[model samples]
Target: MSDKVVKRPFVNNNCIGCGACIQVAPNYFDYNKEYLSEAKKCETYNEQDVNNAISVCPVDAISWI
Candidate 1:
C-alpha cells in the first residue's frame, strides 16, 4: 500500500475575487471576467505556493484534490 499525494488545486463558487490566491501564487491562479480566482493550466507544479494561497483565502474557496 502507498499513500498518494494530490497536488491539483480547485476553486469553488464561493470565490470572492479577493486576489489573495493570485498574490500568493500567480502562476497557479488568475481572475476570470467575473473576477473570481481560477486555476491556470501548466505542468510545473508548486504545492507549497498553492497551499499558501489556500490558507489565505478569506472565503475558503480554494482547495486541493
Candidate 2:
C-alpha cells in the first residue's frame, strides 16, 4: 500500500449547523451555541473519524481528498 492519507475538506459556509462531524470525531469537532459544528484545523488526518463524518453528513458537504 502507498503511504498516503486523504484529507477532509472543511467548508465553513456550507456547513448547516450539523452535529454529525462532532458525533464522529468529538476530539476534532464540536458544536457551537447555535448547534453548528466547529471544525478544527489539524496537521494530520483522523482516518476513522473523517470517514465516519463523511458518512454521517446529511448535505454531503464534507469532501475527502
Candidate 3:
C-alpha cells in the first residue's frame, strides 16, 4: 500500500466570503458573486492550501481537524 494523504474542505455556514483566503491562495480558495469563501474537496488540495485557509479565516472556522 501507499502512504499518500488526501485533504478536502468546504465552505461552512460561518463563511463570510471575505476573499482573504482566496487572495492568499487562489489555487484552492475562491469566491462567489455573493463574495463567499469556498474550499476545494478533500482530495483537491495539499497541506499548503489548508494552512492558507486556516490562516485567513477571520472567524477561525477553517481548521485541519
TM-score of 1: 0.85
lDDT of 3 by residue, 1-65 (tens): 25445546666768877777888777777776677877654444677767877887898766654
Candidate 1 residue-wise lDDT, 1-65, digit = tens: 23344468899999999999999999999999898999887665577898899999999998886
Best by lDDT: 1
What TM-score quantifies how close candidate 2 is to the native fold?
Answer: 0.64
For model 1 the local lDDT of residue 50 reads: 85
Q: Which scores better on lDDT, 1 or 2?
A: 1
Candidate 1 ranges beyond 4 A from true positions: 1-6
Poorest stretch of ten by lDDT in candidate 1: 1-10
The digit string of per-residue lDDT tens for model 2 on 1-65 reads: 35455465464656797687877787767776776776667766678887788778887767664
Clashing pairs in 3: 7-42, 8-41, 8-42, 17-36, 17-37
Clashes of each: 0, 0, 5
What residue runs in model 2 are displaced by over 4 Å at the alpha carbon?
1-6, 32-35
Error of 2 at 51 (Å): 0.9
